[model samples]
Structures are given as C-alpha cells and as structure tokens.
Target: MHSAIDAATLRAYRDTHYRVRGDTPMTLRIDQPSPALAALHQVHGVDCSAFITAANPHSRRCGDDANARRQLALAQDLERMGLAAMAAAGEHPSNGWPAEPSFLVPGLSLHDARMLGEKYGQNAVVWSGADAVPRLVLLR
Candidate 1:
C-alpha cells in the first residue's frame, strides 16, 4: 500500500534505480516510448523512438500510460546527462532495437520502478507484457 504519489519518496525510488543499476554512464531502455519521450525528442532533444511488435503493432496505437511516464522520466534523466534519445518503432520486437541498454528500465522490473512510482504508479505498467522490454539508449 505505498502512497505512490509522494515526491520525497519518488525521488528516493528513482535514486534506487540508479543505485541498483549503478550511476555509471550506461544505456537504458524505457520498454515503451511514451508521448512525453516523443515531446522530449521533438523539443527537449531526446532521441527515443517506438518499440513495436506483432502483438502490438502501430506503436502509436500501442501507446499506454505506464510506458509513457517511464519514458518521460527516462528522457528527463538522459537530458540531465546531455544524451540524445531516439524513439524506436517497428513491427518486430527486435526490429527497432536501439542497442541493448546498459540497463533495461522496464516496469516489469518494478521492484525499483514501482518504488519510483510511489507518486505515479498505475495499473497500466510499462513492462508487464511478454513483449514489453522497450528501453532508453543512455548513449555514451
């Protein structure tokens, strides 16, 4: 029964992800790129694309809330590091791969993301599906 909306706790949760993954400069994935990431790319300088699959084609149509917010945070984190992201979109899970991230950031690995989602956790998780492994490329 986490609050899922406390800023202080949220920061701690996000920090935990970095801690477990290590702060080293590494590439990470958002499992599924969201509108926020798209906005970052369009204006904030993120280079994220969309991750499509046979089950979920037409990346736009596959857009979900959980994935979108994760992508947004990831884009924001990458922006802090001055890294550019590209939205990965395609018809195959492996088709639009943007390089295996140093750390794969997915809601499936919610031990950390969930903690980070203390203030924004949702039933619509970003990495709960069999094909949900979209991540952010933490370009070096």
Candidate 2:
C-alpha cells in the first residue's frame, strides 16, 4: 500500500532474472511472458506463481549466515503452508547484486504473495498469472 522504494532499485527488480533451477531451469523476466513458467504451472496444476526471498531484507545487504537463515525460515514457512516451492534465485544481469536465494511457489495467491514479501521486509516480489507473464509486485 505504501511505496517508498526508489526508482533505481525498482528498475533493478524489473531488470533482474527470477530463475527457477532444477533439471529443467526457468528464467523469468518481469513483464515478459515465459513459456517455461507456463509449462511449470501446468505441471503443478496451478495458474499463479510467486518468486520470493527473505534474503537481504529491505534491500540492505546482510552476511551470508544471516541471509541463509532468513531464506531457510522462508522455505520452512512455505513448506508449512503446503505450497509446492521450487528452489530459485533472483539474479541481476550486470552482477551488481549477488543472487538472492528464492523460491518459485506455484498456486500462491496474489494476496498471500504480497503478505509474504512484506513480512520478509522485501521491496518486491516477482509474480505471475495463468498468462505466465512475470510482474514486479512491490511491497514497500
């Protein structure tokens, strides 16, 4: 509801790649339609997805230990919610920022996605619908 994130940081979120890794990988770009994501959704029988992380909360850099703990906690939360989450990362193409550990959660509702992002103190999360077009959902 409140937007305090700066323009440059917001731009970076848009430019970043939200990658879901495994045997078959997916690179999701904000505002771009991804066939791989569509296929993943179909496989999961879900029409919605969210790419989220708890690392570097509020965009402030933290130690690996701290980041890892936060990320693990988020994963646990997802597991407790019974949502199927795939290991993923948010990467900046220019290598300006270290890849943040993330998850691609199929069937996550938009409301829940926003809640998680804000709960984790994130500026934004990448989300998609049945159209498979990833969008930058800000939570600041």
Q: Which candidate has the highest lDDT of all?
A: 2
Best by TM-score: 2
Please give the lDDT score at residue 2 for candidate 1.
44
Q: In candidate 2, which residue pairs clash?
A: none
- Tell me how far candidate 1 lies from the true structure as C-alpha RMSD in angstroms: 15.5
Candidate 1 residues 41-105, lDDT tens each? 34533233222211112122333554555556656654554444344322123334222111223
TM-score, prediction 2: 0.95
Q: For residues 11-111, what per-residue lDDT tens digits would candidate 2 score against the true structure?
A: 88888988889866989999999999999889889999999999999999998999999988898889898997889999999957999999999999899
TM-score of each: 0.24, 0.95
- Cα deviation in Å at residue 98, candidate 1? 16
Instruction: Mark the regions of model 2 whose C-alpha exceeds 4 Å error after superposition.
Output: none
The C-alpha lDDT values of all candidates are 0.31, 0.90
